[model samples]
Target: MSTILIIEQVLNGLQSGVMLFLMAAGLTLIFGVMGLINLAHGSLYMVGAFAAAAVAGVTGSFVLALIAALAAAALAGAVIEVAVIRRLYDSDHLDQVLATFALILIFSEGTRWVFGSFPLFLDIPDALSGPVTLPGGIQYPLYRLALIGVGLLVAFGLWLLIERTRIGIQIRAGENDREMIAALGVDISKLYTLVFALGAALAGLAGALVGAIQSVQVGMGEPVLILAFVVIVIGGIGSIKGAFIGALLVGLTDTLVGIFLPEVLKLFMDAAPATSAGSSIASMSIYILMSLVLIWRPSGLFGARA
Candidate 1:
């Protein structure tokens, strides 16, 4: 029974990892192609959640709300790419960070102004609201399992887009040498917009899916954004495969630690101390894993040697 419990926690971790991968994929690609670090990526995530919540509130249809969420995020991404982000394309990382930092402020205040301070709620569609049993009597929420399926499908679709398409060729080339690729007559401006939109859509989707489980509110993206950064750093920037693996590792580690640590600690200490110690250590597991990875590889598991 204890073993089954551990397995369930591990599954939960994997599910979390799948969600992280969805966010990390877009982020890593944007960084890889544009050499821009977008702190406002989380804001896009928040936007999607709000879009879904608002649309669902009005339409009373979760499917329509999800579509609106993706579309709104993509449109916003493109507009930002044109209006604000393009200005920082040739500037230093400091400029990019500052500019995106301002974006976070704008997004947060703007969202609050529109939605007010209270969080908006999103409901899972009825068809997916129940639980299902897997082998070995493992029970899981249907919606959560659906999210994993959607994430894997998206990952595969992105892989096909990046690895096989003509635009993908340009993206890969740009990553290799941006100036040289432009010299070869590629429309660098359009490519950047597309990449930005793609990343935004992914973030938006993540937000929409997670909103069903958590409340949709302002500044919700920041914590996940930080975790996404850690995911890419550990998985290897510019490597989609690395992001997938890293996200899964992080999700699993976090989930397992959260569940197992208290029990492990209890074996040696009192319940109160064990619980406190377990909670603290579990919260830090991903960062601890990240530090260990850096100490060992410096560049990350799949990162190119720098």
Candidate 2:
């Protein structure tokens, strides 16, 4: 590929990584603090997209739509936590999984019933609707550039929250010793609700941002949700630092493989076969990388050894 093409792909990869970080960060936080395996997390993502789409359709304001997304997802998360998820904390993983999976069905059906089975659309804000020139004469989408900025800001904000604040201390403490914090009069239940809502808001933000690029439809969160799980696993469960690093690794690997592997293979085979082989191999690259990482460090790069 040409230098410009490579540069563009790199930007795409960064954008993808940032988005995954948003999702994985939340997933890790929720898992780390609550010790709950929530299969319904993806449902929160879908709720965000639908909320943004619906709001944008009526108000014609992207900012309002984003706000709606955050509010709707956070509200949904808190309600679910109080109504169902709170009961699963002391339960086994299988129970958590079954309950959340049932939630997935309820969310999907509820969404379809309210919005109809048709996909919704979100338009990029006019300010970010065009392409901009980057270093080395690379032209990239303005919306995507904005997304990278937003992701970085969120990452920094999360770092500040986790490392520099009182709530952060409570969160860290809870992660380390939930019972101790509860004994210390930390109102553990309220903290759990806050953390769940925060995580849900982050997922919602991701969904709203990505909805402009991809079609907003039912079950859209499943693919990204799976990728987010992989990201956290590779990064070390409950480690935001690891999640960021892992997300970048997976994003670059996926984008580069999908784009350039065929070109690399052309050197050894016919054009058509090279293309087909390249695509096939690229599809497995992330899983292969995960396997290799597990072999090297089963607890993940940053996770404490089990």
Candidate 3:
């Protein structure tokens, strides 16, 4: 199609990738550091979105909603860690998954009970609602462009947080040897809680940001959760750098294929068949990419050797 359209889609992919990074970054940290397979992490995301929606509705302020989202998600995560996840540390992935899956149901129903089955709406700030002219006569949404800037900022911030500070050192050490870190006088339990809460807060921020564009609903996190899982898996389970790169690769691949597959297929096929086939395969593009990555490197592109 048009070059402008391509550029727009690429931007969409970047936005989506940034959101996924927020989700996956927390997940990778939790898994790598705590050794906990938390299925309920997605629930934290929903909690953030719903909290933001409810607060914004009452307060009429997006900034307040955002703060509430972060607080709610972090509180929920810490509580869960104390009540449920702490016990699962020595347990198997199956038990962790089942318990967290149940948490997902609780979160969905709990949210519906409070907000009802109807979806909550979020409005973009007035300043960001207008379109801005880009290079080459392209006009784009200021809000979306803002999202890209926010995403890039978050990416850099996370890198600095994980790689620079003393806590970051502890997190990396915990990821490498949990027992060793524990033996060295580190309060590993507290560290785990902090990590979980941090992860939840990031997920919440993503939900709040995305809520402006999509409806704020109870089950909104599941789709994103799955995508985040795919992202981390492709990037390598415990690697932040890998997750960032993998997210970008996935976002671009998914958006480009979805937009251009039909046109490419129409070269040899009828428009109707091309459109249908292209749409179907486009949906499958990420999975196919995942399979290819796994086939060539099972541990992921940047995973440490087993």
Candidate 4:
């Protein structure tokens, strides 16, 4: 590939990575703080996309759509936390998984009932619809670049929240010792609700942002959810920093491999076979990376040792 092509792919990788970070960050936070295996998290992502699309269709305002997305997802999260998740805290992972998986079905059906079976398209705002030129004459999508910036800013803000603020301290402490914190009068139930809502809002934001680039529809979050899980596992279950780095690694590996692996294989095989093989191998690249990382560090890149 040419230098420009490589640069573009790298930027694409970064964009993908950042989006994954948005999804994975929330997943990690929820898992880290609550020790809950939430399969319904992706449902909240769908909720956001649907909310944003509905609001945007009505108001024609991207900003308002985003706000709606956050509000809707957070509301859904809080409701579930109170109605369902609260009951799962002391339950085993199997029960949590089963309950959340049921939630996924309910969410999917509920969304279909409300939005119908059709996919909705979210338009890019005029301000970010065009491509911009970079220093090396690289033209990139402004909206995608904006996504990267937003993800990074959120990451920074999350770090500050966890490291510098009282709530952050409680979250961290809860992750380490929930009972102790509860004993210390930390209104653990409220904190759990807040964390779940915050995580849901983040997932919703990701869904809304990505919906502009892709179609917004029920079950849209499932695929992304799988990737987010991979990111968290590779990054270490409860580490935001690890999630960020792992997301970048996964995004870069996925994008670069999908594009260049075929070229590399073509050197040794015919184009058709090479393309097929490359595509197959590329699909597993992230999982392979995960396996390798596990071999190197069982707890994940940033996960605390057990």
Tens digit of per-residue lDDT, candidate 3, span 146-260: 8888888988998999889999999999999999999999999999999999999988988888888888888999988888888888998888888888888788888889989
Q: Flag regions of model 2 displaced more than 4 Å.
A: none
Per-model lDDT:
0.91, 0.92, 0.88, 0.94
What's the distance in Å from true for residue 282, model 3?
Answer: 0.6
Q: Candidate 4, TM-score vs. the true structure?
A: 0.99
**Which parts of model 1 are misplaced by more than 4 Å?**
none
- The sequence of per-residue lDDT tens digits that candidate 1 reaches over residues 136-155 is 89888999889889989999
Instruction: Please tell me which model should have the higher lDDT, number 2 or number 4.
Output: 4
lDDT of 3: 0.88
lDDT tens string, model 4, 1-306?
789999999999999999899899989999999999888989999999999999999999999999999999999999999999999999999999999999999999999999999999788889999999999999999999999999899899999999999999999999999999999999999999999999999999999999999989889989999999999999999899999999999999999999999999999999999999999999999999999999999999999844
User: Model 3, stretches more than 4 Å misplaced?
Assistant: none
TM-score-superior candidate, 1 or 4: 4
Clashes of 4: 0
Error of 4 at 50 (Å): 0.6
Please give the lDDT score at residue 151 for candidate 2.
93
Residue 260 miss distance in model 3 (angstroms): 0.6
Ranking by lDDT: 4, 2, 1, 3
Report residue 264 deviation for candidate 1 (angstroms): 0.7
CA lDDT of 63 in candidate 2? 99
Q: Lowest-scoring 10 consecutive residues by lDDT in candidate 2?
A: 297-306
